[model samples]
Target: MQRGMYESRAYATLLLKNILEVADPMHIMNLKPLVFTEVSDRISDKATKAALHILVNICPWGRNRHKTVEAGAISVMIELLMDEITHSKIDNVGSNLALLSLNLNAPYKIHSIHME
Candidate 1:
């Protein structure tokens, strides 16, 4: 999946979201890294948004919030927010970022997220 083109990855992420509706914890853990990677990829906003939506769904589960923080989702979401704000192109990303912020318990780490 990593070697696929951006469009393919975007489609795969959307498909994964559908699968995650009935997925187990093990499935969540296995998919988290790839989803987070796609969130930061920026090669396609479609892919990024799909990945962020997937994270929003899985983050509320047991231990997934901490794992998301460890995966650097906060920083990536913040970066995405900054870009969207600057460009005035905010979309579904705002709610995803908001959900992540509310779910994560790592306030101490927010200051460390790079803005530039």
Candidate 2:
């Protein structure tokens, strides 16, 4: 059987955490638009989660949120959320979208995601 998206996201998150610890994640921040666009692609559950994990990790740093917003985080995240929830039938997307919005201070039409 295929692994679940949660497992994919968890592994992706772990790998990104390692990258952050070892390398300069500043490179990631620099490439914000391309990175966000890749996540918006949603090519696979694993890929999507990996990109989102990177996005989430990088956004906490200085000016990274601004970079993300400049990179079109709001639109990309909204598309990713809509695609995950509506098209691909994925789960746990709302949380990531909310996290991006909170980091970017992005106002969006979709709301009501609670911490659980």
- Clash totals, every prediction: 0, 0
Worst 10-residue lDDT window for candidate 2 reads: 107-116
Q: What is the C-alpha lDDT of each candidate?
A: 0.62, 0.55
lDDT of 1 by residue, 1-116 (tens): 67898678778877876787678767765554555655555556766666666666676666666666777876876787777677765664465465567656543232111112
Clashing pairs in 2: none
Best by lDDT: 1
**Global CA lDDT computed for model 2:** 0.55
Most accurate candidate by TM-score: 1
Lowest lDDT 10-mer window, candidate 1?
107-116
Cα RMSD for candidate 1? 6.7
Q: Relative to the unseen true structure, what is the C-alpha lDDT of residue 47 in candidate 2, on a scale of 0 to 100?
A: 53
